[model samples]
Target: MSSKELTDKLVAAIKSGKYDAIICNYPNGDMVGHTGVYEAAVKACEAVDECIGRVVEAIKEVDGQLLITADHGNAEMMIDPETGGVHTAHTSLPVPLIYVGNKAISLKEGGKLSDLAPTMLALSDLDIPADMSGQVLYS
Candidate 1:
């Protein structure tokens, strides 16, 4: 399904108050970025941005915490300035780690992608395993 559809369902789920946790991944940026078409990537970002506001509102209604982060960077450097060619692969650049909520969650610095797991667990009020390598991003 498209990002809109997925987001709509998520909003409904959030409003329903049926679950303690909800997780969503919009594949538009990553999937479209893989095509190495800058124009398409722009549209993809616009679409994701449009959907995010609705999500933020729903999260506020439920007084829930939201952690928004991408697995990797793509479409940001679609055109390789050095090679003057289309870059179709993921970039090594750091991805954004955004937290949205009424209650503050202090984001820890030096957090890696692995930190997402621990962060989610913390948000859900679940215990973190001792062997887990990822650090909790919020305290």
Candidate 2:
């Protein structure tokens, strides 16, 4: 879908007031970056930024929480040159985790992906199951 359409739908959902939180992955940075199109990647990042801004606005209207993160990093920082039409394997570089909400959580530098689930659960006032390996980031 076009950016405008996507934005409209997101705004509509936010206004619906059915959910308490918003979890979104603006895939442009990851997808466009994989093709080695630097310009397109930049544009995609801009688009994602705009989408994020809109989402944040919606969240603000309801005094709700917004969790913005990525499962992995494929854009912004390219560690190596693309070769012969083949993109490089995923980097060991850490992904970003940003939380904007009422709950308090402190994320230390070099945190691992495993820490996310527990942190989120804690934020929602939910218990982290004993079987989970991650600790609550703040608690």
Candidate 3:
């Protein structure tokens, strides 16, 4: 879906309050980055950022919190240092975990994707399942 559509849905969901939580993933960056088209990739990233800004505003209106993260790094590193060409492979680099709103969680560096679930549960005061190996990212 387009970033605008994603933003509209998320804003509606947040405003509706029908669900306790929601996860909105913007695929533009990742989808466009794969083509190695620099301009398109940049635009895709910008679109995602714009959507994020809108979503943040919507969530704030509801006094809700937000957790922003990515499954992996892509458009963030668009060029290769050696060949000076577009880098298409996914990087091993860590993705940022941004917490927004009044219920912001304290972040610890060196966190992995696995840490997200436990951290979300902890933030919501929900019990972390024993079978899950991931630990909370915050103190």
Highest-lDDT candidate: 1
Query: Which is the better candidate, 2 or 3, if ranked by TM-score?
Result: 3
Q: Please give the range of 10 consecutive residues that has the lowest summed lDDT in model 1.
A: 102-111
Q: Relative to the unseen true structure, what is the C-alpha lDDT of residue 63 in candidate 2, on a scale of 0 to 100?
A: 73
RMSD of 3: 1.2
Off by over 4 Å in 1: none
lDDT of 3 by residue, 11-112 (tens): 998999898879778888778868888899889988888889999899789988888988898887789889999898777788898988676457898888
What TM-score, computed on C-alpha atoms, does each candidate reach? 0.92, 0.81, 0.94
CA deviation > 4 Å runs, candidate 3? none
Residue 6 shift from truth in candidate 1, angstroms: 0.8
Model 2 stretches with alpha carbons more than 4 Å out: 78-89
- Candidate 1, TM-score vs. the true structure? 0.92
| Residue 76 alpha-carbon offset, candidate 1, angstroms | 1.0
Model 3: clashing residue pairs? none
Better of 1 and 2 by TM-score: 1
Best by TM-score: 3
**lDDT of all predictions:** 0.88, 0.71, 0.85
Model 3: lDDT to the true structure: 0.85
